[model samples]
Target: MDRSSQCDEPSSPAESPSPPAAHGENEKNAQFLTGLRLYGVLIGTSVASFLISLDTSVISTAIPSITTQFHSTPDITWYASAYPLTLCSLQPLSGKLTTIFSPRWTYQTFFIIFLLGSLLCGVAPNSSTFILGRAVAGAGGRLSLYSFGTILGPIMGGALTEKVGWRWCFYINLPAGAVTVATLFLFFHPPQKKPATPLTPREKLLQLDLLGCVLFTASIVMVLLALQWGGNQHPWNSPLIIALFTGFSITIIAFTIWEQRQGDSAMIPLSVLLRRSVLFSVLFASLLLSSFVIPVYYLPEWFQIVLGATPLQSGIYMLPSVISQLLGAIFSGVLAKRIPYYNPWFFLGSSLLCIASGLYTTFTVFSTPPAKWISFQILQGLGCGLAAQMPLLTVQATLITSPAQIPLGISLVLFAQYFGSSLAQSIGGAIFQNILASQLEQEAGLDKTQIQELLRAGNAKVRETVAESFPQSLNAVLEAYNMSIFRVFWFPVTGSAVAFILAGGIEWVDLRDMASSEGSENRVVDEFSKPGAKQGGSRAGV
Candidate 1:
């Protein structure tokens, strides 16, 4: 059982491996930061993480406000999907950019880009600018920082939307980002690395794989257009939508061929993708992460629309789920440390997700009990939390013996997460919009124009508008929204079921044992964690 056999082709060395001296951080430069200085850097990184994480889900609660302001109900899917679309597309390139430039410089550049994106979003006069700004903000440099934002973004967004305005959601990021820039400039510094030789401009551009990125991005955009337009704006049988789907398949094939040719220089290296554990991790992570995001986006809508809660109230309503998720993640880490296997945790989590998604399907216009919703949310959160982080960990453990694959493996898992989330939001919007339209037309007797008007008015405002004009039809319209939202549960249910199936196929090893030897521990730190040694000390474990 050689490690190379795990890949489709034997694992090859990197195209241009870093030199011995470039292993990261010279001994003399590794002096410890102490007193106030270390704390400043730590707080700075955490604040940066917080801001990035907040951006990931902040739009969840602001959608209704944004839709109202832009009056672009047709483009609602783009509002949610745009960020993830760009985020997923650029994630692989971020690491390469970080390596080519120093981390500090790269960090500063991305932060500035993110700040500009936020400013644009805050002052956006039209839907196109807002969506473009979101895409730019989403593609801001690091996936790891975004992961933290996903955890707390909804609550922050909801509160901001309620207190100030939806614009403040974007505006808040400006000051926070300014602080991050200041801190990084003042406190953060990685040892400088001089390339063995200066590279030509063409060589530098080739290292970034710009062509492959464009092809892959184009393919994804085609798939999104197909999904967004089919059976919604256009018929499923329409030639335009069909052509988009066809183009997606062709471009994906071309991208695959290109990746194979690039070998080690490929953005998502072909050899790493061929590994069985890596494959399973990508699938499982996509499914599980989608499960997490679907609820985050929709539950607030449910709270505001069905229960007549304000934005702040909707955020408050989500406390059970958010709190439970954090608890479950903490417990899962503790359990993983002690247990030799991960399948039990996976099974437990997915089973809970299945039950929670099923329970959500039971929600109705009259289902206003706080306890029922809270309990269901808690269950769903616990389920996703328990298994959400496992895919990455399991992939790392599988490649413990093949350290070079760790970075690619981690990146693939993360890419699946963002990509799946993008798909989930797009599909959810399509389903909800289509069903809501039909339900309003057939059940509530609203015409096409009226339905569009109502949707453009915003979810909370829709109820108010209808109640004032057609009081008798209010209940019917609310019921239509309820049923339409309930239908969205199927997405997470199916995602959880698939995750449960994939979890069983994951390869597991005793991670603690894998890192027991000092040399192996160093290897784990070198491979799975950050590239450079810390200013103060070295960290152990994968």
Candidate 2:
């Protein structure tokens, strides 16, 4: 596909091999990374992913604290949604800026912005201030990390809850962001990105699309708010939710049309989505990845409620998956460089996830063993390791023909990521709720006596009658909740199956194929690197 015309064209230099070589250790690392052909963008993005994942996951633990602090649930979801909404909204822009502004500067600037937002969130005096801080933190949160990994390297995703606690998830970005900035500045100096030629002031001014930016933000905001509120706050049929949806829909439509009319200056080009491969990749990516919502949020909840573990212990249970994920991502990158192929890995990843989820579904209160749970998670992690970054490999490979398309491709990946998580969260929540409702009804099987008791409790406004039914209701709700949650794995399983099937159609494009045809090539390496390869050290970032 002609990704350049199809998507927002990045202004960066062609992503070629041979980084002009760095000094001593840098040179060795560079060679190794190049040999594995590491994506520098991935290193920066891994850091970003750590921060963003932490922001999303750590909050569940802190919610009780937040509730105590704020004295209400009035805007609980607001705290979490602020960052994702911003990340989703700014994704298209951020993905491009990495190429337009030099990935170095784009990352540095956004990491700082993220850090500042984190600081404000950590020190927030009240819920409103904290939410505002999260909003600011969110702007670059999703934008920085999501595709930088794909554009440059295999970045690992994770939360910050382990070391600093829930608040630290936001606060932890301070030092981590600083360390990331320092690492890039000190060790990684990208080639100077001079424009092809100097542009006239008018030409440069004309290139800037202020209206496009405004429209993009407006569209994302409306869509996110509508999603957050609809079926949760107001009924799905409410006017406000309806209005927001319509406004966002129209805005997006107008933006698409306007971009086509503007031609080269369009924020997002129409051609990107037009390509079957690009379009299908995005769809499959979203569909398969949507299943991650269960692991991200509910895993901790499960540990807390079902196994009766502390937040920290729950975080520990996740350590295996998270660590394995890091290993899997790096291994895939290294493998891709050492050998070449993507289709099998993609399918394997989806299959593993499906099987893993299916395994988790077997968990039971009295019948199950502890080892069974861990064993299933291990298999799931193995699959996760395989497929997680392989999609990016294809996406990046697909865009190699048009370096300009890299930014939009990366942005789409990030946008798809959080958007998938958010959508899955909502859908999964509803699924869990319905299961809980039905299970509770069946368990209680309330009779006329219970109904009379309920009426008496309500009419008399007495606590006694209500108390009688509450326990039964609560038990039913909890049991159903567990069932629904464990079942959430099926989402990714089903989505993954389709993704796996669709991936069989991807042309076995190799990195070596792109580099040179006449020069000597690692034909063997090309054949072997199906999933990906490890770039440098097995360095764990998050």
Pairing residues by index, what is the TM-score of model 1? Answer: 0.90
lDDT of 1 by residue, 1-542 (tens): 11211121101111111213534543344445676666766666667667766787788878877887887765778888888788778877876766665666766777778778889899999999999898888776342353356556777788888888899999998887777778767877655456769777688788998888899989988988788778878998999998999999999999999999999789778788778877887788788777767777788888888888888788778778877887787787767767877668878888898889888989988855888899998998889778777766676667667776666776777678778888888888888878988899999998888887787776648778787767788999989988888899899899989989987777766556666755664675554223331101000000
RMSD of 1: 5.5
Question: Against the unseen true structure, what C-alpha lDDT does each candidate score?
Answer: 0.73, 0.54
Q: Give the TM-score of candidate 2.
A: 0.69
Per-model TM against the reference: 0.90, 0.69
Residue 222 accuracy (lDDT) in model 2: 80
Q: What 10-residue stretch in candidate 2 is worst by lDDT?
A: 530-539
Error in Å for residue 490 of model 2: 4.2
